[model samples]
Target: MSSSASTTSTRTARPVHTTPIQQPPSDSTSRIPVTPAVLRSIFASSRTPHEERSISRIAFFRFAGFLLSCVGISLAASRGRGIKTGAALLGVV
Candidate 1:
């Protein structure tokens, strides 16, 4: 009879649904400890051409750095290497 009583009765008359909610499938991707092989695969699958080119460039630089490090290490570990090679490896040449 009162407004508050009528509102309460109306709220109580509504039924609650019991259906379970569905979830999407999980598909994860991560970019860490990036290597040339990984970069190449990522670049191939990428939709944007510009980003792929940038990734390729980064891979090139990464490979170049690895080669340079190998050369320096080889020169350092060789028994008969001169002081000039050592100085060069140490960036004082």
Candidate 2:
């Protein structure tokens, strides 16, 4: 009886206490951090000139193809627009 009661007390025991987190007091006099300038400097350090443009070209073309697919699907879904498919088939020949 005593062993079972002790086992149940151990299972239900409250956790050991721990110290609370400590931090510096807030200071209104501290200069507000400038995020944009820091971020700009970080990006500026990694920048390359024409290589960015070349990447932009590839991304633009990939996006253009994605846009064209939506247009093709829209055209195919319209009965009158289905004529574009016949035009495409003709172009292949």
Per-prediction TM-score: 0.38, 0.38
Give me the runs in candidate 2 sitting further than 4 Å from their true place: 1-45, 80-93
Error of 2 at 36 (Å): 11
Q: Best candidate, lDDT-wise? A: 1
Predicted candidate 1: what Cα RMSD to the true structure?
14.0
Q: lDDT per model, in order?
A: 0.76, 0.74
lDDT of 2 by residue, 27-89 (tens): 857756669889766765686867667766998999999999999887767666467776787
Error of 1 at 55 (Å): 0.3
Candidate 2 lDDT score relative to the true structure: 0.74
